[model samples]
Target: MFHRYLNKVAVVTGGSKGIGRGIVKVFVENGAKVVFCARGAAEGEALQAELNQSAAGSCSFLSCDVSQEEDIKRLIAHTVTLHGHIDCLVNNAGWHPPHKATDDTTADEFRDLLNLNLVSYFLASKYALPYLRQRHGNIINISSLVGTIGQKDAATYVATKGAILSMTKAMAVDESRYYVRVNSISPGNVMSPLWLDLAAQTGAAAEAIKAGESNQLMGRMGTEDECGLAALYLASEATFCTGVDLLLSGGAELNYGFKSQICS
Candidate 1:
C-alpha cells in the first residue's frame, strides 16, 4: 500500500544482513533502486544476485568500512556515479561488543565501539549531504533502545547510541532549511544473524536469546522487518517529521525492576 519510493535511489550502509538487510528488502519491494554496502564481499554479492533474480528491486553492493572516511566517500561517489542521485540514506551499519562494564572495557575497545557505532553515522552523513541536498532527500539512522534507558554492562554501546540520538536531532535542525529530513529509529532487541555471531563469541546465544525475549512486555524480541518498517516510515512517508526518534522498543523502556533484561 505504500509503494511511494518507486524510481528513487537509496543508499543503505551495512545492508548485507540484519536490520540493514531488512530495510533494503522493503525499499526494493517498494520499487527503489538500492546501493547497499557491507564489508562482506560474499554476502554482498549473494544478496545482489538474489535481488536481481527476484526482480524485486535493482541493487548493487559495494564493500565499505563505514568507520573510514575514505571508504565512506568512495561509497557515496560510487552510488552517485551509478544511480545519478540519492533520494535516501539509511545509516544502519553498527556493532555491539559483548556486555562489558565501563571499568572492564579497555580504552581502545571503547574508542573502537564509538568509531563503529557513532562515527560511522557522522561520516556517512557528511559525505552524503551533497547528494541528499540536491534531491532534498532523507536520512534514517538506526539507533537503539539502550540509548534511552541505559543497559547494564553495555556502557560503551549505550554511550554511542545516546550520541546518535543527539546527532540526529542536531543534524535534523541543521538540514531542515534545505528540505532534507533527518531522523532516527531506535529498535529494541531483534533476532538477527548478529545474535548468532554473538553466540559464537560469548557462548551464550541460546540463553541470551531466551532472556532477551522475556524482558519485553510482549514476551518477544522484535523482528528485523518490524524495525525496517519503522525506518521506512521515517525515511519516506514522514515528510513532516524531522529530528524525531522513533522508538521501536516494544515497551521495554517502561518502568520495571532494575535488573538485567538480557538474561531474564
Candidate 2:
C-alpha cells in the first residue's frame, strides 16, 4: 500500500502518539517523507528517532502547538524547508478533556477545544493550500463519530469535530479546481494511549474498553491500523473522493443502544 507513496512529502499534525502516530507510520512505510508535529517535544523527538531507525520512511518532528497560528505556520514552513514541497496534509492532532455536561464545561475549556481542534485544522489547511495545490495533493482530517451522532456530556468536542466535517466539504468544493481533494475520517473508540490514560484517570479503563468492545458488532474497538488504511485510501486512492466522512467506527453505528446496555 505504501509502495505507492515513495518519496512523497506529507505533514501530519498531532503525530506524536495514538492514531496520529499510526497514520504517520503508515505514510512513511509507504515511502513518504513525513514531518509530524506535536506540543510534546520529548515524545515527538523520541518517536522521530524510533521511526527513523525502524521504518524505511524518513521522518522529522516539530514541537509546534497546533492551537497557535504562528506555530502552525512554522510547522508548514519547516516541512517545506526540509522536504521541498507538501504532497499531503493530515489534520490529526486533537484533545478532549473528557465528556462533561454543558454546565460543567468551562468557557475556557470550550475555547481551547475550538482553538486546538477546529481553528488549527483551518489554519493548517490555509497554510498548506499552496503546496498542496502545486502537487494536486489531498487533505485528510481526523474527526470523530461524536461529530455525526453527537454525544452526551461532550458538547464542545462534538461541536469541533462537526465543524471539521463541514470544513472538509467546503474546502473540497473550493479546492477542486486545483485538484486538491479534501476528506475526513471519523473513528470510534480505540485503544489509544489517550484512552489508556483516561482509564487510569477515571478508574474506568478496563470497564470502558470492555464495554466499547462488547458493544461493537466486531466485539472490539477499531484499531489504529484500520484508521490508517482509511486515511491512505482517502489521501491516495480517492481521486474523485472529496468531502466524504469515512466512518471507521466498526459496527458501533449499527447497534446504537449497545453502549448503554453495559452500564445499565
Candidate 3:
C-alpha cells in the first residue's frame, strides 16, 4: 500500500458517493486518515466501514448536510477534534439540478443552489482554515468543466461552479501567507451516479449518455477513480500549485466545432 499520505488527516464533504467518495477512497488508500461526511448516514457509514477494512490509512463518517451553515462548521470542528489537525480539506459537496434556462430558473432555486454548491465550500474553508494553517494543509474544491465554458440551459448550476472557481483563486491568495494552498478541479463528463441521473432525466437516456461520451475528445466519459487521482495529486503533490483550476475534461474542450466535424 502506498504511504504517500500516511498519518495525514483529510476532511472531505459529501463523501458518501460519486466523485466525493472517490476522493475519500484515494486518500485512505494512500494512508491518509480521512474524516468524511454526507447527508446520508447509511451510505456514509457503509463507505466508512468498507474503506477501513483494507485501507492503508483509516476513515470515519459524519452525518452532515453541507447546505446548512451549522453542519459545515460542525463537520470541520469534529474532524479537528478527532484528529487534532487537518492536512487537507476537500469541499466536494454539491449538486447539479436538472437543466433550466435562465428564464425558467427561479430566484429561490438559484439561492438554494448557491447555499449548497457555493456557500458550503466557503463555510467549510472558513472553518477548516485555522486547522489547515497549523499543518500547512491544502484545499481542493470540486468544480465543473461547464463552469469554464458555459453549458446550455444550465445557467444556475454554471453560476455556482463558476463562483467556486473564482472563490478558490481568491482564497488561494489569502491563504498563501499561511502556506495553505487552494485549488479546484473542473471535471467534464465524469460518469458517476449524479451524471447517470442527469442523463436519465433526458427522455432519451441512451442518446444523452452517448452524446455526453462523444463530447470528450477521448470518445468516453471519465471515471470516479480519475477524479480521485486528481484530488490525490493536489493534496499530496503539486506543492507549487495554488489558485489553479485543473481541468479533468478528457480533452472535451480542445476543439471548436462539432465532434463529428472535428474528428472527421
Per-candidate Cα lDDT values, in order, are 0.88, 0.88, 0.92
| Runs with alpha carbons beyond 4 Å of true place in candidate 2 | 256-264
Model 3 vs. true fold: TM: 0.96
Residue 121 error, candidate 2, Å: 0.2
Regions of model 3 farther than 4 Å from truth = 259-264
lDDT of 2 by residue, 1-264 (tens): 428688889999998889998888888777889999998899889988988996767899999999999999999999999989999999999986776789988999899899999999999999999999999999999999889988877899999999999999999999999999999999988779887876677676778778768756788887777777788788878888898999888767784463362553
lDDT of 1 by residue, 177-203 (tens): 899999999988888888667666678
Tens digits of per-residue lDDT for model 3, 85-170:
99999999899999887888899999999999999999999999999999999999999999999888899999999999999999
Runs in model 1 deviating more than 4 A are 199-202, 258-264
lDDT accuracy of residue 193 in candidate 2: 87
- Model 1 clash count equals 0
Model 2 lDDT, full chain set: 0.88
lDDT of 2 at 132: 99
